[model samples]
Structures are given as structure tokens and as C-alpha cells.
Target: MPRPDRPTRPSARSGVAPFHVMEVLAAAKARQRARGDALLLCTGQPATPAPRRVRAAAAAAAAEEVLGYTEAAGDPALRAAIAAWHRGRYGTAVTAGQVVVTTGVSGALILVFLAALDPGDEVVLARPGYPAYRNTLAALGAEVVELDCGPDTRHQLTAEMLAALPRPPRAVIVTSPDNPTGTIIDEAELARIARWCAAHGTLLVSDEIYHGIDYGRRCASALESSAAAVVAGGFSKYFSMTGWRLGWLILPEELVGPVTRLAANLTVCPPAVSQAAAAQALHPESLAELDGHVRRYRDNRDLLLEGLAAAGIDRVAPADGAFYLWADVSDYTDDSLVWCAELLDRTGVALAPGVDFDAVHGGGRVRLCYAGAPGDLAEACRRLSRVTGRA
Candidate 1:
């Protein structure tokens, strides 16, 4: 039997690209353990803790209620709370039956992909986007069609690009308050893209994970444009609940059942305590507290921008929303990975290389997240200035 081809060890689908920012984060952690001074601007996790009410609610649930699994689609109360939250934010008629809570936005994405895509189906997205979108779809045998988005368009996708694609995709993802680059698609332009997708018979997966963290102008939710879109949202960003493992997807009536069936087989249900606590997370007082965190992010962003310009590294993406500043570091090095590794070594300041976001043209770019305290950001800028010889 020819020795059975040496026991073909791993599945080909398991070879999805590593989310490289995680490697950067691992390095940062190691540097911190050794020197106790590393500054991490690589991940988008907020510096603040979860809201007090959320924490208290989780604790109360632990103390008072059984932590067994709820329904596969998640707790009806939590889903209802999420629907009400959307109705208040975007003036949409969101009903509880349309919501499916998942382990996180990552989990929601997997269910969404499984429900909407078949093998060989194509999904169109911007090139310099969240890497997981490509990796997840590829792992499931879906074709990822990338549109090149650059500075001329402020790193956003337009309806014109969708029309010009070789063929319409099975789905198109729109991330406002985008990852890596904090660019917000204009509300009017978003509506145009929504209409284009509708006309082309394509599913629109709107990732509004960073909804409440805009810099100046308010970002619009896709429900304001297309009620048919599958909206993926989570508590990680604005709610400061990264480790809580709670997120929800708002689907059209047709999709809810399919996605719920997938979730039943995949996750069984989201965490019981998390769904219980998330109900309190939507409280008015909790929201007000979360807004304060956004204010701190804005302050940190301003400081980093000024400091980077003073350090003579001026080429940057428009940080219209989100906590990341996508910076061009071509003046320093052509390869961002090497530059990032060396920068961490020399100054103990870690940032994500842009290759993680844009494999085509991101070797000379970097993304620095401002979801940290002002003091840490200022000290990081000081170290960067000194290390880059701009001091």
C-alpha cells in the first residue's frame, strides 16, 4: 500500500492563516514578563473593565441561578433586550425571533458563513480588512474575493467597486468603524452599497462590532438601509466585555432557523451566565458608563496622532471611528513584520504589522490601537520617538 502515504497528518482545511497580530501579542507578553515594561497597542481590547452592572449581574447569576445551557438560540430575554437595543439605536423594527446569540462575534461569523455560503461560493470584501473574514471563509471552502481599497477612497468599499467586480458574490461584508484602519463608510455610501447588494441578489453581512466607538460623526447601522442584511454585533468592543464571550446576529426570518440549527450543533448555546448578564449590559446606566470609555479612546487617539506627526511619521488612515490608527511606515522599513519585531525589542512598544490586514500591499504599514490609557499611549510615543531617532 506504499506505506499509506506516511499517514497524511493534518487536514488541509486546518491550514488557515494565523491571525498574525496574535503573534505580535504573544511577543509583547513575553517581553513584558522579562522586562516588565512592554506597551501593547496591537490588540483592540479596551483598557477599561466591564461595566459594574454587568459584572454584578454575572456575579448574581452565579450566586442565585443554575448555570445550565439555555435554548440553542440563546435566552429569549437576552435576545429581546438586544432587539430593543437595536430599535433604540437605529430606529429599526428588530424582533426577538430574529436574534441568535452566539459565543462571540467570531462564533456568529462562523454560523453566518455556514448558513449563507456553500462550497465554492464567493464572498467579496475589501483587501485591507479584518483577516478572520478571509481565513474563516477559506477554511470552509468559500472563495474570498478581495477588492483593493486604498488611501484614495479612504480605505473604504464603494458601490462602484461592487458593480465592477468580475461577478457578483454570494455575500458582501461591510465593516464600518473598520478594523486595522478606523475608517467609517459614509452613511450615504453605505446605503448605496446596500442597494447594490440587494439588486445583485447578494447577502450583506454587516459587522458593526465597533458601533459605539466613533471619533466624531455617528456611524450608521445597516438596518437603517437594508432590513434584509445579516447584522453581526458583539459586546467585545464598546461594552468592554472581550472575555465574556457574548455576541448576537440579527437575521432575516429565513436565516434565523438555519443559523440556529448550525449553532445547536456547533456551540449548543452561548454561555448561560453571559446571556444573563448581557441583559444588564443593555441598561441605561451601563450604556452611559460605556460612553465614558469611548471618550477616553478619543483622547488617546488625539494624543497618538499628534505624537506620531511630531515624530515625522505622518502618513495615516483617516481614524473616523474605532480605536486603531493605520499608519504608513515605509520611511522606516519596507517589511512591517521585521520592523515591528525590532521595535518591540528596542523600545518594548508593540504594534500590529499591516500584513495581517492587507496581504497584497501592507508590508510597509502598521496598525496602532488607542484602546488604552492616555499615560501608556504617551509613554509609548516617547519610546517610539527615541527609538526612531526622532527624539
Candidate 2:
């Protein structure tokens, strides 16, 4: 407590970067309401609804019984379902006791960071990766060391990179079907990195939130390689349950008690209704419906890729999975934030600036999301052609 004579000040921990995509999104919303012509390509997350069965379960849980707080870790049935899901999908020997549900991947990361990282402990991140991970870790007082990943490695970190470091950092994060760039890591490479982390005693935080939305390449879970990896995933992106606010973590046996205790104190529990209904998301009926959404995402990705090419934006990351296309707009402008603003104002096209993700090379890059209506993506491309003068 500060003395009465002195004013209290904000801690240094709060000094973190903002998600500029959210800012662009807010402005896009305002433009949409005012002009009804905004083509929002900046947003992440699938533009779809929860699975039919999952929604039905939510409705049933709300009407059939009292919706109350669940166990801090989560509903036993849901935990078992997730554990089984992981086991079946990745052939990992996961168990219900190791699954700790949280509000979202956001919450799970917070819990794991608190449990695993101490202030000044170094954590490795791929450059131009998800901003939230870097921001959250920074705010938690972790030393973030970003690896300058480019098209050479599909904007991902490799085992060779880690071995070359002065020493193994406290932890390293790997995101497949990564946000912003949307590149999926190679399975063989992922296994090698996992083994390296285990051998070197560095914690590996594998973020697999965008699984099940791949194109030609398949996404691999770190659990398939090493049991020591802390895996965080959510129903948001692939399941189209962003609002349901349900996510989970698969922890090592040693981490279960600590993460659960921290979650119990910090969140009390994830939304009870979500826990009750989310298990249904794993059902066969719901999965069939969800698979249709993935097909549409693929179509959208192709359309966007073709359109960007027509607009003379040739440089791009390999978008093997996820619904994003990372494009180099250096020909049009050196400042992505300004370029995005001008495009929004002139043609009502909202795009995520690269500067939000990479402080080094983001100025001339932009990320466009193709998860929305196909018509909107096409029209946004047409409008963009006028600005780029490539048509």
C-alpha cells in the first residue's frame, strides 16, 4: 500500500502491446453500422455457429437442470470426453485427471504461465505469431524471446533454432495452423522439436486451437511426441464456439494439481453451461456438421488466394491450414496500420495490419481472414484491386 501522501501507480507488468486487429475490428463495426458497406476481413475465428448438438445440449442443460458452477477443473464427463478426444485424435495416452478446463485458451495460458513461469524467466515465441500470447506472457512478467521466423520456415520455430540458442529458455510455444500467418508445422519436424525440448528440459507449450481446419497437410499435437508438453486448445476457432467461452488444457501428471489449484482460485470455474454442453461437441452428429464448415473454409482460402494474386499481391505465406492469408503489401505501402486505415475509410475493407504481430517486418504486411461469407471475400478483393491498380 502506498502512503496517503503519494499516489498509487500502475505496475510495469501492465505495459504490454494491444491487439491491433481488435482495434481495426471496432472501427470496422462502426463503419458497418454507419454505411452498411464494410467488408470485414480483419476478424479471426470462424464465422459460423456452434454445432447443432452442442447448441441443443446447451438449451437442454439450461431448461432441464440448475446451471451452477462446476468443479474448478471442469465437469467430470466433459474432461473425460476431451481426454478421450485427444487420445483418439493423436494416439496420446491422455487421461481425464490431466484435463483442466478453462474459460478459453486465453485462460488456460494464463493458468499455465502462472504455474510454470516466474518473472524474468525467458519464453520463446515465433515472430509474427499470435499477439495475445506475447502480450499475456509479457504482462505476467516473463521475458519473451521472439525467433525471427520468415517464409523459410513457414513462420514457425524449428528444433535447430532452439539448439542454437545460448541456452534453452524456460519455455517455447508452438502454434500449428498459427494465427496471422496460418501455417501448419510439419509433423516430423514437430516431433523432433518435442523430443528436443524434453531432452533439454525446456517446457513446450503447444497451442493447437486451430486444429481440424487444415487443408492438404495434417496438424500434429505435441502430446503425440512428448507427454511433458503443456497443450492448450479451445472450442473457439475450429468448433465455432467463440462465445461459448470454453477451452481446456492437457497437463503432465505433475502439473495437474498446481494448474487446477490456480484455476480454482483465479476463475473459480469455466462457464457451467459450456462445460455441460461442450461434451456434445465431440459427438458424431456434431462433428459431421463441423466438418462441413471446414470444407467452406478451404473454398474461401482458395478464392482469397486467387483474388490476391489478381490484385498483384504475389508474396504470401503458405496457408496450409486455418482461414488466414498472410500477404506482403510492401508494394502498396510501407506502413500496414496506415494502409489498413485508408482502405477501410476509402472502400470499407477491413484488414489486419502486420505491425500488430511482427514489430520488425509487419509494416509492409497484412493478414486477411477468409472465414466470413464467400461473397464478401470476393467483393473485398474487387475493391482492393482498385487500390492496388493491378486489375
Candidate 3:
């Protein structure tokens, strides 16, 4: 019999840290309700619906057969299609065996962390990055070493930064078209980082979740250089299938078995219905619909850029891709959490505090997502200008 007074056993890894952006958004929502406001700008989700084809594909799959568990690595057909996609898009040669369909990019990150790191291993991540990389590493009992890469370096991790580390990390994570900043690393920089990681025997995990939403050059995957690299991508952003919860990964041949085993035990497999729908997401017509959304995001990006400049919050990194604008808010306040909270309360305008992305320098900045409707973006800009006294 268990003793009632005994404390519950806890995992060695700490629990995942709360994403501060979610907290800001939640507070903003509550404030909006309290004030009877009619606007919101605190979300990172697309205002548009998932493409018609993606929906139709899922509906068709639902009618055709009973959805069941797929193989842990995912359906062979989807894997093959994903492989074909890489080849067609980037002219990179890859086989279906290297592709592993995941529930989403989040699941892929977990699998990568588990397969790549042992207890007490360290992984290098950029500060002001997607919070998940740090949280996930901590949750997996790995020390997250944050390298400060600010606006001067285009908010990306560089080879010099990696070489400067006291002890080389076991792995390094890089996100092109990164969350918060929306900066895309160029080919030259990516090649250098890949070479550095390869020479150092550091596992490289590239999060290419926003690959298709680029404004200039298409983003490159590290798989283009290092066979040891893991490329995690998803349909949530560019494909606008956030609720579909479908993503896939390209793993090195050697790590495939370990990742497959973990996936089998943890998730069992991604939803068969979502996988079936995802298969159609690869169809040419479905891709066309996705491309249309990309065009809209580009427009939204331009709108936000212009609005920010006009609003006098001009010190922002050039947004080459993704749907966010990371702005320096030190002029107004140092505590982004407090500033964001007050903005939400006073103006009904919500934004993510940088503290959520980088606990060190994030307090002086904020992330504004432009994935909302055009009217919403305009209204947000107006409210932000008025609130900040920049109008």
C-alpha cells in the first residue's frame, strides 16, 4: 500500500516553461472581454481558413475509409511524397526512407531531442528564438545554452558564435524564417553553420516550419549539406493547416530506427485522417492553394512593415520571412511583459512579449504577428500608434 503522505515522484527533466506569448494573449482576451472591446491582435495563427483542397481531402478521406493508426514513422506514401517534394522544390536528392511523418513540428522536436541527446547533454540555441527549443531541451534533461544573436547578425546563430562556446554542445538548433524575428538565413551563412556543426560532431536540428512563406530567396534545409542534420517542417504555416496537426521530418538514416521506436511508444502514430488529408496537401492543386496564402502573408508583411515605420516603432529587423515582426520597445519601456499587458488593457491591442522568446534581452522588445486579417492589422497598428503616442 502507498503512503498517503508520500510526495509524488517527478521526472528529472523540469517541466516545460510557459510560453509568455500565450500568457499575454490570454490576458489580452480577458481584458477585451472586461472592457467590451471589439478587436484583438494577439494571435500567431492565420486568419484565413485552411485551403479548400486540404479540407476536401480530409473530408473525402473521412468518407472513404475508417481512419486507423499509421506506422509510427508515418504512411509510406506520405513519406514518399514528402521526399518528392524536397527534390522538386530544392533539387535536393532524398529518398522516402529518410522522411518521418510526425504529428506536428513539435513532435518532431521531441523526437529529435530524445534521439540526439543523453542526460546532461547540452544543446545550443539562439536567444530571442522559438521558446519551444529551450523548453523542450530542458524537459528532456538537456541544458539549453543560449547564444545571443541580435539584430546585427540578422537574429541568427552563426559559426563564429558556435566556435566561441566554452564546450561544444552535443547539438545545435537553428530556425530559418525564425519565429518572433521572421529572419531567414542565407545560403552562405547556412553552409558555414552546417560545416561547423559537421566538423564539431554537433547534431544540427533545422526548424523549417516557415519555409514556404519567404519574401525573397526560398529557405534552405540543412539536409542540403549534412546527412547528420534533422529537418523538421510542417503544414501549419504555409499550408494553413494548423488544426490538421500534421508535420514530417527528414532524419539521417542512422537515427531513423531510434526515432521510430520513440514515436511508436509515445504517440503510437499520427492520426490516420490527418495523414490522409496531408497526402492531399502534397497534391499540385493543393500546393497552388497554399501558394495563394503565401501571397497574402507577403502582403500582410508589407502592411505591417509600413505600419510600424509610420507608427515610429521603426527599429525592427528586416522581416525576410514568416508572419512576425520583432520590434525593439526599449524606447517606451524595458519590461515588455508589463508594456504588453498595459497595451492590451488600454488599447485592446495584444502582442507577445520578447521575454517569452529570450528571457535575457526579450524584456526590451516585443513580437507582433501579422497573420491576422488586413483590417485587423490596420486596426492594431492604429491602436498601437495611439497607445504608444506615436500616432
Candidate 4:
């Protein structure tokens, strides 16, 4: 008897905007196949593999162990490894009981949002931050409040920003070594935010997936300052296990049951083989091997920075950590998506358009991922410089 809002169409949540970088990635792949000279600066994954020890462990587990559903929360050993990893790195009192492993950091965030937030609850995020955080929260019926952060704060939200909000939000996410702009939150600033959130009875979701790949900044944890805060961490970034799709959350004790219950219903359990193999990713031998990847990332960052500067593409963020540099291309073109397409067409180099990250002030911006091979990054910059001189 009621007018149908959809008129028998698909649900509104399905209309969430997709990541434009995926389209660029498709074109880049096609170009690579056609010309074999494509330089990809569009995506965030490392051009590497899981550590040797972890790969060996994965092969052994696949061949030997029964790869069935794990416990809804995760493998006990892997959970303990994550909790211990937190404790050792941040001097925090984390326990395996507080950790719930999910399919990936994406899964952890979805579960936590479902468990902790009701529809209409406000969740604050920094503009020019990771787009998935904004898109996912919107799809889950949360009111996403984006704060406009700028160069003064290193493009990160702070306690001051929180205080300026009209009212305390239900939750807020802080991503250090942030995507697009590789700026790391200062340890003191992070502590201040943690304290503010605890005081305001707000949930703090710290996305620390890129912790180990920093260029020297101390990647602090929310657990260090507030027991009330939750941490969304994963093996995808620093551990070089993106395809494995293994991640874990350090939740407050009260949230552990809720998130695990959601995981049980939503995902049943994470991949059993990934859980078993990921525990090896925590081994000291695995860490030693992964540290070498960090060195390569550093070298690529420097090489790209130097090359970009030579190309007159120097209006960029500090890039304190992570593998991306956020640059303002306002001078070249008003439409970044078009700019990116054209750049790829002419140079066989793909970069992520800034609009994918920040809907505002992103028309003339682009994010360059330096996670590729140094030779490719150097070549992409060369193409850019040659075009700028002619234009």
C-alpha cells in the first residue's frame, strides 16, 4: 500500500561511488599488455611478495593442514601474535583476548562499525584521507563528517580539530602514514587525540596498516593512550600479504564479543590457511626479511621525489611515510580524472586522481604511489617532465 522508494530497483547503498583508481588500473594493465611500457603509480600495493618465511609457511600449511574455517575470531596463535606485536612495538598492555582477526583491515572496519555504531551516528574523518573509510561509513548509514585538514597540521586531524567540532562525534578514525598524503601523525598529537576521545566518550578507530613502512616517524598506537580506543590493523601493508587478506583488530574488551559475533555471522571465519600462514609473518626471521622491503620503498620514494621535482611536479605533501605523494595539479588541469586519463594515454603512466580521495579541493590534485619499481617510477617522471616542457 506504500509508495516504494526504490520502485523495485536495487538498494540505495549500492550507489556508493567506486574508487576511480580501479579504472586507471584497468587501463594501465591494458596499456602494459599492448605496449609493455606502462608505469603504474595509481595503486597502493607493494610490487613484492609476502616474506620468504611466510610464503614457505603458507605452502607448508596448504599442503599439510586441513584448510577449513578457523574460529570466528581467528586462529589463537595469530591473535596472540598480533597482540604481542602491539605490546612490543607500543609498550601497550594488549592481550590476545582483545584481538579479533578478520578477513582484512577492510573487514575489521566493517565489523567494528556495525558493532559500535547505529545509523545516523556521526563519524568524523579527515578530507584527503583514505576514500574507503568515507565510502564504507556512508554505506553503513553513518553520518560522515569530513574535516578539512591542511599543510599546517600535516594534513592530519588533531585534538584541536575535534574540540572545534560542534559536538563530539560518535566515532572518529585516524590514519597515520595516511594514503595519498604519506604524512604521519606525531606521537604527541596522537596521544592528545586519544585522551580527547576517551574524555568525550567517543570511539577512536586507528587505522595503522602502514605502521612498519614509515620513513622514521614513530607510529604510535591508540592503545598506548586510551584503553577505550580500537585499532584496525592488517598484514596487507607492512607484511606484504595483501592477497592473503588477513587482518586483526585490537578492540576494547567490551567490543570483542560484539565484533566476533558479527564476524561469525558476516564472514563465518577468516581464511584458515591465511591465518596459519600469517602467524609466520610475525616471526623475527620474517620481520628481518620484510625490513629489506622497507628499504626498497624508501629508495623508491626518494627517487620519485627527485624526479618529480625535476619535472616541476613539486607541489606535494611531505610524504613522511607510506608510499604516496599527494600533489596539487591545479596548474595543469581542473579535471583530475581527465588529467589522469590523458597522462596515461600519452605517457603510459597512471596516477590516482585526487578526487577519489577528497571530493573537495581534489579536482587539480593527484596521488602518485611510489610502491612500484624504481626504474618505472623514474620513467614515469621522465615522461611528465618532457610533456611539461613542451606545453
TM-score result, candidate 2: 0.98
Output the number of the lDDT-best candidate.
2
* TM-score of every model versus the real structure: 0.98, 0.98, 0.95, 0.97
Which pairs clash in model 4? none
How high a TM-score does candidate 3 get?
Answer: 0.95
- For model 3, the stretches where C-alpha displacement exceeds 4 angstroms are 1-12, 31-38
Query: lDDT of candidate 1 vs native?
Result: 0.92
- Better candidate number, 1 or 4, judged by lDDT: 1
TM-score: model 1 vs. ground truth: 0.98
Give the Å shift of residue 179 in candidate 3. Answer: 0.7
Residue-level lDDT tens digits of model 1 in 1-391 = 4566547688899899888878889999999999999999998898888899999999999999999989999999899999999999899999999999999999999999999899999999987999999999999999999999998877988999999988889999989999989999989999998999888899999999999999787799888889889999999999999999989999999999999999999888999999889888889899999999888888888999999988878999998988999999888888898899999989999999989999977898999999987888889989889866899
Better of 1 and 4 by TM-score: 1
Misplaced by over 4 Å in model 4 are: 1-8
After superposition on all CA atoms, how large is the RMSD of candidate 3?
Answer: 1.9
Output the worst ten-in-a-row residue range by lDDT, candidate 1: 1-10
Q: Candidate 1 — which pairs collide?
A: none
RMSD of each: 1.1, 1.5, 1.9, 1.7
Tell me the lDDT of model 1 at 289: 97
Residue 294's lDDT within candidate 1 is 88
Query: Model 4, 278-307: lDDT tens per residue?
Result: 988888999998898999999999998889
lDDT of 1 at 99: 94
lDDT of each: 0.92, 0.93, 0.85, 0.91
Model 4 has an lDDT value of 0.91
